[model samples]
Target: MKRILIILFIFLLSACNDNAAVEELKEDYPEIKEVAEQFPESVQEKLAAPTVLPFEPKNVSLTYAGDMPGNPKRDILHTEFIYGDGVGVNLHVTTYHNKNTTWSSDEKTMKTVKLKDGTEALIEGDAINVKQIRWKKDGTYYSIMLIKAPKVEKEYTIDDVVRTANSMEY
Candidate 1:
């Protein structure tokens, strides 16, 4: 009986993990992987609270499936995400940050652009600073930019923004 139970437990664990991985893929694109590949992992750790991660192409595909906006050009870190909550958003970020504009609502303003693909089923949500953390209450997705200037000021999501808002940092 013990052997049978253990086998079932392992199988169940594996199954659950697989589902979660798939769900995460569908929810948050492994955009972090792309950024991590180029930059040091410590960057993610050093990230300050209320940081608005640069929207990467990987984030867009994972968050929402569709081709990225504009041509696949360099310099501009443009991308878009698809949400299951009947919402879609595109992001256009720059690698260089103006020193004078280092930190201000000016850099954290919002803009409304049309999804070139125009095939996703989602509602456009508000911008979390320059970042768009929409809830794919319906897709799967994740990231910060590899070349960053610390302009991340928002993370719009259907869920609580500061989930750890109440939890301790222990």
Candidate 2:
């Protein structure tokens, strides 16, 4: 009985932590909160968005990409936040129901980083710019990509992407 009580306490504590994290994300990104509220609780939990972004986005949009190719029941969600028409930061956050799968990249360009929750995230890019950050948590795969844009004065760095990934609430 004592052991069961202890386990229950731990579970409740973790749930509270998750709730706090979700509240923080909602407070930090009202757009995410607004859009997420439109979905069911199950879908909302899978639709994780970053609390941090590299640039101040001029526009933000979320799209339901339907199911994954092989898995008809698994859904895909794509959220995009962009800063400029064609020349500034364009961040894409994609979430799907799957074991964490990462995009193929040259081995030389891929490295792993530990997120705040100690999840291993695969980052693919060069020394100066980060192309993508991918990680999996709670049976869901999440990816954040910096889409190539023309006439950009500055490109986001690996640190920027890492910060964004860490800010994601599962």
Candidate 3:
């Protein structure tokens, strides 16, 4: 019963295209007004035009596992970069482990052309940071975790390292 009340309370706070829905329901029931009245007008404005909602980033998505690639001490934070005509850069900062510099140390000349649906990245010694552009796969979002140091590097592997973050809604 308590959980039901709480759930109803939260629903009352959510944005609505019309107030009539609540009114119609409440016309036969008056107890809902307490929960509705607690809501601030600011949140209500979202009904007209929502600025932000619970949404996963469009194209790319990261998945964090128990440990990171290459090093068990590291953790990956992943998210999909939206694939499109735009920009992105993945970052990681930690102590003890060197960021992966696989991109900077490659002797082979790297391709300069930006491939559509490719994540351009910056790499340091142990971190494989990629500036991810999104790509669609089986209707799921994904980003390549690659590394590129400024100069001097070996081959940059597509599966080097990538991490995902967590999100929750109330």
Give TM-scores for every candidate, taking all chains together and pairing residue i with residue i.
Answer: 0.23, 0.61, 0.19
Candidate 2: regions farther than 4 A off: 1-40, 67-87, 98-109, 127-130
Taking the tens digit of each residue's C-alpha lDDT, what string does model 3 give over 19-128? 45334423433543443333333322211111121222222211222243345344322211221111233322111111221223452343322222343332223334
Kindly list the per-residue Cα lDDT of model 1 for residues 31-141, writing each as its tens digit.
634532332322222212112222323333322222333433312222222222212334321121112222223423533232223312122234343332221111121
At residue 86, give the lDDT of candidate 3.
17
Poorest 10 consecutive residues of model 3 by lDDT? 45-54
Best by TM-score: 2
Candidate 1: global Cα-lDDT? Answer: 0.29
Which is better, 2 or 3, measured by lDDT?
2
TM-score of candidate 1 relative to the true fold = 0.23
RMSD of each: 15.2, 6.7, 18.5
N/CA/C clash count, model 2: 0
lDDT of 2: 0.65
lDDT of each: 0.29, 0.65, 0.29
Point to the candidate with the largest lDDT: 2
